[model samples]
Target chain A: MSTRPLALLLLALACTLRPAEDHVRLDERVGRAETPDTLVLEEDGLAAIREATPRGARLWAASPVLHLRLRTAGGPFELVVRNTLRDATLTLDDGTVIEREPGGLPTEARFVLDLPAGVERTARLAPPDADAAGSFHVAVLSDVQDAIGEVQDIYERMRADPSLRFVVSTGDLTDSGTRAQLVRFQEELETLPIPLYSTVGNHEVPGPEAWHDLFGPFNAFFRFRGVAFSLVDSSTATVDPALRRERLRPWLEAHRDAPHLFLTHVPILDASGLRSGAFRSRNEAASLLQELADAEVDALFFGHVHSYYAYSLAGIESYIAGGGGAIEEELDGIGRHYLRVEVDGARGVLGVGLVRVD
Target chain B: MTRRHGRRAQVTAHLLLALVAAGLPAARVAAQAPRTDPSADAPAEPPPPEAEPPRCSRARRRAAPALALTAGLLLHGTGHLLACERRTGRRLLAAEGLGFGALVLGGGGIALTGASRKTVAPFATLAILGVGTFAASWLADLYGTLSGGANAGRPARAAPFELALGYRYVHDPQFAYGHGLHLAAEGWLHRTRLFGGAWLALDDDTQRATAGLSQRLLGARGRGDALDAEAALHGQRFGTDGFRTLGVDVLLRGRLELAHLGPTLAGSFVEAEVGLGLQGFGYDATGRGVREDWNGLLLGRVGWGVFLGPSGELVAYYDHRRDDLAGGLSVDSVASGVLGHFGLAGRGYIRDGRWGLAGELELGSALVVGLSVLHRGAAPREGGAR
Candidate 1:
């Protein structure tokens, strides 16, 4: 009896685990407070996270460089970097080495340089892009949770499309909501030429704190140019009817006139409705579709169905862009791919193009 | 007696409330067809009181029990295990008693006249005794009818086809979303009832399906009176998860009636069932080789059902199974009174995982609602009473 109790205690402790520690983090001191977007890191600079941690992964190097949105026409700007010794030599894209100034703080390498705005560059110290929100070309991706190891091809594909501004994903960035999966996912994401904004999927439901630590929130609203995007939580089917009358209805009503796009991990109804593999309640799904139609939402994108499908329901254009390096479905006849959505400031959505990577 | 009557009243009340809530209103699918001929639809014209048969001679009234036995033995009438009342009892008793008594004499006489002494007397005697027992039971039924009780008549026959739709929430932390839609259909051909269904996640790319058949070898059409043998096949798909399953199941079920006194469980009953099955599946994650395996499992269940009038049933059951069906590849699901005709339903095996709190009403005829929904007894393509 006593032994059984002891075994249960240990089991409980094993399940409620803390985030794993990264063995590859640089121990060198750094200046300024590190965040997620500051330093430019190569593959070597990205620390591989330990597996099975409760909180998943996080990116920090004082601040890893995610994007350089240059707004000035042309001017001198300071670049910050970490994990270095002495005054490091900074190389430009053309292979020109400039001696770093013994600047700001001794813990980091800060370089002040002049560059033209509106131009994108990749270098040893400042792989960069200018702020160009005027052309909103986003790559929609999802369901790459356990397959981050195979995502390098996807990243390369995005880099090839310099016109693609960034990535917007619905969820499933990891397989088991583990720290290692998140870290690996983040590491692979850094390979892309642009940053990624995403809302958590069911796989990210391990705990809200861990998700908040990495991605801002499970549901969010952000706008670019003249179009708006809303990412809502459909992670749990059979949502309370009141949720519609409360949060969702008001939000949709507020943005009724704006060209808007909705993002979720699940669809209101599967195109293969015959299989009944869609929402829990036809009543609820029909209501959601009606609401979207009433709001005249531009498009709704989802990613739980590991396949590429495009269809319209209740007059709303919808697509399931789930081919994100996870297991491929032969029936879908499409290889691993992402949807490239072109948006014009004045005209709203132009078209959705399939970019196959595998 | 009063306790049982009160339960019947309570069950009737709940049944009515459930019926109204189950979408039975002006929006009903169709009006039920009348069962009787045109004249029967109107109130019966009263006959002169002088036409009433003289109350069974007081002496014959006391002999009603014996007469019931004699009539029932011949397979003719009924025996009223009666509770004397101020009125109506004897009227019902007379209908059952005299009717059955006539049949016993008639059917028995035919049996005797159809053969010679050696075969005739034995056959006649056997026929009389058999019919007598039948009549006794019929008379008891007459008593129940006079009581204006539910479950007063034989239960509705299982239609050739059944369709059900509902919602479910799974508690598998390893899986994607937890809630989804459920759709099922079953057909009857003689002794066999064939069924199939699917469960799909509302948000995630998860889906499961199953098909099966159950044959009632003996007993039926009433609560606590049944025996059945069943078999089935199952399949499922979790998109991108690279998981699938195929399986077989077999089982036997039996039940017994303890009392025929009231509607619902106010009438006592008992049931027992046992089953065994085998499941096989293929699973592959990452670049790992396709892994295949077969597993065998055991299951047991016991429950009781209450027949609540023209239609409707309330059942309570406890079930136990040794393993998860199809290694999580196939979802084993059901609608209506969890046991297919009773109350409660739930799926899972986390010690506290399996449970179902359900209620059904035969509204506009039959539609189970609350937590789950099941449209019962409408034959395929043909309109049957709801």
Candidate 2:
């Protein structure tokens, strides 16, 4: 064949070798910009309650206090604290002097409910005649991105045991919150067979509208089982003095009563006692967290900074589940993992397991 | 030029025909392996109690892509040796001889690995290409005469078709600052001698094809085989993010092609050259002289090919070139000829990944390099990821 004809033939062959597919779908799920209906906070209506007055704290104020008015099975309970610091002690309603550290409520501190001397064993543990109640299990997961296999593995493990009541994602549900990314999360969790709750992290807030929409009905401050779980908006954690004093203070005071499990994105004040502020703020917001910790809140779970960090502060136990998402680099001490919590009656047992999926 | 173009067209067509004949049949075999839906029979198979698939041998998985790439390189090498216009008959014979030897070695390596262990295919193919490069480089040193004309002595440039396949491993010294190093199969095929006209094959489906022709003319030189001037006319293309590129380079290379090595390798020439390439950056396929800039390159090479032999013998000393992109994005064009191919068994040359350096000049620019590693066996398939 002539060179022209031969060239034409080769061109034809090259053209015929069309690629298998033209558009390679990339990971593009930026999640629903607005809260999805299922994730909204509608079921727990009391969470909708707004405080009549805005409350706050001042650093200059001497000896700030957290007034605790919690009601247990036996009767109404009240404790008093003078300041927010390490090893602060609390006096229980029954004049029980508890030498409390500025960490989770003393692990051994438990109220031995008074029951009839001849009460049945079942009734003793679960009193049908109790004045106070407890029946909520919140799932806490961290560092769920970057390692899809690990996430899937954890999800599968959870699925095997249907006892899992509900799930709480500490934060960092994604490496990058691309649209498809959120979809992957939703698809993986759809098999969970229970509602999944999320506390907003820096990753979740590239824009308020998107995250607020993705976790709609389930995204609100609400009471689950019986414990009140509060999600502290990172927006309120900013260095903006006005936002800190005006916004966060009121939110904390209004939800002070019920057995509380606080959720936050960033860990407050590193071991060196320095606080991080959003938008380049300093330790200004540390006092607010101190006040809450003094109130003897339940475990506070957080994500971001993919590593496992646990600390105790003013009668409160704080657990960091940052390993729930993508882990960019290996930490000196922590591996990727999720916390499986078994909560029954008044006490909860937390176990951490490092999971890997091929 | 017309005769050269005609021969190239013929060879390309022949290669295309051969590739199609070989690739289509194997593709059919794969297509027949039950493409309908394995998910349908799930009820009977009962998911393997194990949740994840066992780790398969990496060599087995990479075989198809390896073969495809290897074949492409051999075909490309053959095209260049046959179509090059300025090369002497002796040089041409040696180039073809080297190319054929590379194909045989690469093929044998693949088959041996397959018969014994699947993991050795990529390494085998890499060995084949390494040897083939040395042959071509040595041949270039012989027949490619220098321009002793107006400016000074420089090699008469030949636009040989260049193609290669290899496996690559890269690691950045600064761990925290940049992305981690990765292992990938890569290849590139080009028909321009200026190192300016080439299509990079990243993975399998993505091919960044350079549009337009590039011409490099020789110029004056100083001692030590250095060139005084070099020129080029290239087309460029840029797509998404920092990957934006589509510009032509027009340069006058002031470098020598043959170097005078003393007595050991008598009359065997070894040369080094360096010069500036006036580059034009624009959004045109025909990369003709557009918005131009002075881009520089440095080349050094040496070879010894006997005048008579069934398969002309030549030792390719070295061939290296570097180009810098003005402003923030600078690319260092390189093609080094390693001493010997130890892993695949024989005396051969190796072309490390084509590295492009960026970042702080004081600390030296960061590099994004390309590699083409091959092993012996049936030639790797050409239509998949490298």
Candidate 3:
């Protein structure tokens, strides 16, 4: 055989092996975004700076924690952060507290910082109540596809609960992942009392790559009060093989000894195999489950099936809570609901409660 | 272009390239061989000599193809019945019915059990078998309808033993393996057939091997159409990925001669198999030392093919399993979640049946292409009739 065909085949293989752009863009925006001549903002997790200026910055904290380093010429600065729990507080490295002012939106928190000229001062912002090694509650919601209009009521219900720290979603935040729809979803989040972290779902694939641009990273990890949360992108029914090997495996390994909760848009193995609302390959699913089992993950959460299911796989507690008011799966009798998961730093998941909105 | 469109274009281009590559050799063989009745070289036992049967009219023959293309595609065997092959039609229909029954039972079991891993092996096996039988019957119906009726000549039987050596190319985005050396051997002794194969990746440190034995349950092994009960053991080591797997399976496999369905379907055959297996995956690089986990595996295959001369055959098949190298598709549709991989394979002997050439292509989560040279220990035997 001529080497020409072999060379062409190799070229084609190389071209095809290129990773998905969504993951690349996501990796780029995870840690920090910079604005020249202004303060440099750094986040411990998958947060994004929607707007940045010399005096202040608008932040979307995908995770509950943010670390900001100011490079100002000794003056007062204002910082506005969104998607944070109600009890969030800002404190200087010297242990001085910075009181939060009432922002324009209920979910927003504004803090004034006085910085010494030519000296970079670091500030830590986080929910103080969730920082301890005690049990806390978090709300889980997903699949608000066409129900974007009706999600406010769900958030209202969440807001009424004083015990809930924040919300985490498995994805499908809009009917389509269009920029307008994503912005609308974020706008509605202003009604909620706490932050909502999410991974993208299959429904988000159709519209151009606006989900990541608007909502930060599709894959992320964070720790709240000692409990580890890992969110992965299964929007296309399969995680990119590279992502699984390089990102997911490391995330699992890093939190192997902690009380880790894994969340993704699609279930790795659908409890009801008939619907197959899960990974594209059962082998892949099996492999992933084995990895999780080896790591001793506390629980798995997923949303895509439009109904709720609580099942166990590989000895780990798993739940599918897709009841965010999308078209319902009829006759199941459960609709428009979210899960209230309680976790402790010292212990694993305490319990998962189902909260119905309608 | 958009990413989706780009990916589609790439897949289409590769598919076309594979088609052209596969067609060239087959086309060359076709041109070299004489244009004669395909049944003259059928690899099945000949029917006992009998009085001449009335031939169907041209319109009836044409109608069979039409029916097969239309209703027969869904209602398998309708075309065979229309062509007056009552026994074969009824058998095909029975197979279809049994397939559906198995599907229902298996699906219901899976749902009832909540797809629990404990009891999933048997149910999944049934489901895979059901799907394979259903599809194979339909394809068989189409083949029987299109093949022109020819004399049911006995021709020659299959070689008793064969050895093959080959090279395989695999393109999987998940792995770095690109080239593999393949070796295989199979032999028949009395009523049993034993086969073994190995694939060693040349570019990466991955190796896989499979060994199997099948006991003939019905029909003659020499005729190349039989019902077999098989047991197989397979193992693979992904040296670069720090993992390995070992599995064993038992299957009930059958190959039916389409000529038995009708003389018009001479020289063609359909095969179906379903099985269950247990596999253990061992990981070497986890936080905890080496860890091993087990999972249930469902295996199934269905194919349609035609005999090539007296000792060769070409087949197109669907393999409903993901544990192998081809794995499963990673598409953006629900099919990615449910469907398996597709493949095409062919082998033909030359140089007085002492040497042969084989080629294969598989499409799944990966694309695999392989070509091999075969050496036969014995030439096909002649003078046998059913």
> By DockQ, who's the top model here?
3
- The candidate scoring highest on TM-score is 3
- The list of candidate 1 runs beyond 4 A from truth reads A1-135, A238-247, B1-386
Which sequence of candidate numbers ranks them by TM-score, best first? 3, 1, 2
TM-score of every candidate relative to the true structure = 0.41, 0.30, 0.69
Q: Which stretches of candidate 2 lie over 4 Å from their true place?
A: A1-132, A217-219, A235-251, A271-282, A328-333, A342-358, B1-386
lDDT of 1 by residue, A1-358 (tens): 4699999964543221111001001211111122232222232222111111111112232112222222223455555443232334456666765566664433245656565553544444322222124546788999886667778878888889877765778777787666667767766665564666676565665544455444434555544555677766555432324445555678788877667888877665555432223444333344465566667788989876667778765556789888786554433467689999987655667889999986
Between 1 and 3, whose DockQ is larger? 3
Best by lDDT: 3
Superposed on all Cα atoms, the candidates' RMSDs to the truth, in angstroms, are 24.9, 26.0, 10.4
Tell me how far the alpha carbon of residue A192 in candidate 1 is from the true structure, in angstroms, after superposition.
1.3
Looking at candidate 1 chain B, the ten consecutive residues that score lowest on lDDT are B329-338
Please identify which of the two predictions, 2 or 3, would achieve the higher lDDT against the true structure: 3
lDDT of 1 by residue, B271-359 (tens): 56666656554443221221243444344455544444333445555343212211111111111011111224321111221222333
Q: Scoring model 1 with DockQ, what do you get? A: 0.01
- The total of clashing pairs for model 2 equals 108
Ranking by DockQ: 3, 1, 2
Give the winner by lDDT: 1 or 3.
Answer: 3
